[model samples]
Target: MAKRRKAKQRESRAPRFWGQHAVLAALENPARTIRKLWATHDAIAGIDVPPDLQVEMAGVADLGRLVPQDAPHQGLVIEVEPLADIAIEDLLAGAGDGRPLVILDQVTDPHNAGAIMRSALAFDALGLVTQDRHAPPESGALAKAASGALEILPWCRVVNLARALDQIAEAGFWRIGLAGEADMDLADALGGKRIALILGAEGAGLRPNVASHCDALARLPISDRIESLNVSNAAAIALYAAQNSQESR
Candidate 1:
């Protein structure tokens, strides 16, 4: 009976969002369906709890048991259903501002993916694209890393990344894959056209097949002494470069 109960808990689909930013962001987003809210007395005092939502008052030690070990919950945690998936076609249809889009090629690290989302929002990118089978799902750590951008950014998970690249190309995006070994620098390769900045997982870099789908491959102007930038940092630099390039045009 205990084993069965533990299995059920492990299989639960509801995502628990911890940390002040993650919890507060979800509370404010109208589209987020919050199932339960647990907070310390002091934490609850500052929050404007929704009248219709269920809330539980708990002590700090009690709250610790509810989240992963060593997680900094900041005295709040929330159980919520995953956000509804946005269709790639819908994202393409709504792409009018010429904002660049980011496509992650098997970036499975939740923290990295979340940080990329934060950068995407900071640079006014259209959205983030990941393969449905290889991407990290919305989770507490990811949400915490995103620090509220997860609620604002549109994330589209597609089945076949190569096929999606074809569709994005059909919509007139100039896809540029970032590779450490690429001959051209990012700035030299970018134009005024709408762009899709493609980044690969750390260490492995962009797969050959994915690179083949891009309009061009470019590299950051980093020194050879350091091999590569962390995926999230690289993303921030790429976005900054793209924004500057667009404004200069």
Candidate 2:
């Protein structure tokens, strides 16, 4: 009964998801709970909204007010319960030559995390893992930045990232940490092994202990055009390189 009440409370405070990408993605996810929806008539014209969900017709202005200021709602917004927490063991269990995993260390910015989620899905990653306390919570901005990947991708949060790394290693993953200061290039770090790519927040880079947990540290072969790439961009590049390496092998 207490758990049921907690679930009710959680459902009541569902995050508002705006923009067509975020809203449609949430709608399509079987695991996602749609609490309330406010959308322009045109936004629902061609879309098939769930019969059980209550959708409130509204004007563009009404939709705008439902989300953050100046947020591009794209004429739709929906209050949705965040997906259930995913277990790291579940991710590791599928760690066989399946998609590589991307782990973030202290990537607290929702936008960066969302973009990394987007990239992870694009490159067919197994899942994204983040340290629970150092990661961002589910939010409209994050959903928007993910561009629907939030709904499709498996995102796991763990209390102990170092311990999770140990489990990943035991699952036969070749953990590679991406650092700008690393000596070896990212390509050199890749082989025929199932990869677990680790990226840290921009500027700060990987935490010392987190870097030590990885099997190898690699740097992207970017020229002196810029000092470093954003964490999200770096994630995309690393994922692509890892996936490409697998295909060749």
Highest lDDT against the true fold, candidate: 1
Clashes of each: 0, 0
- The per-model lDDT (C-alpha) reads 0.90, 0.87
True-vs-predicted CA distance for residue 139, candidate 2, Å: 0.8
Provide the lowest-lDDT 10-residue window in model 1. Answer: 1-10
Each candidate's TM vs. the true structure? 0.94, 0.94
Report the error of model 1 at residue 36, Å: 0.4
For residues 1-249, could you state the per-residue lDDT of candidate 2 as single tens digits?
Answer: 000111223233678889999999999987788898888998889999888889899998888788889999989999877777777777676666557999999998989999999999999998898987889888899999999999888888888999999999898889999999999999999977899999988889999999999999999999988999989999999999998999988
In candidate 2 the C-alpha lDDT for residue 173 amounts to 89
In model 1, which regions exceed 4 Å deviation? 1-11
Badly placed stretches (over 4 Å) of model 2 are 1-12
lDDT of 1 by residue, 182-244 (tens): 999999989878989999999999999999999999999998899999999999999999998
TM-score of 1: 0.94
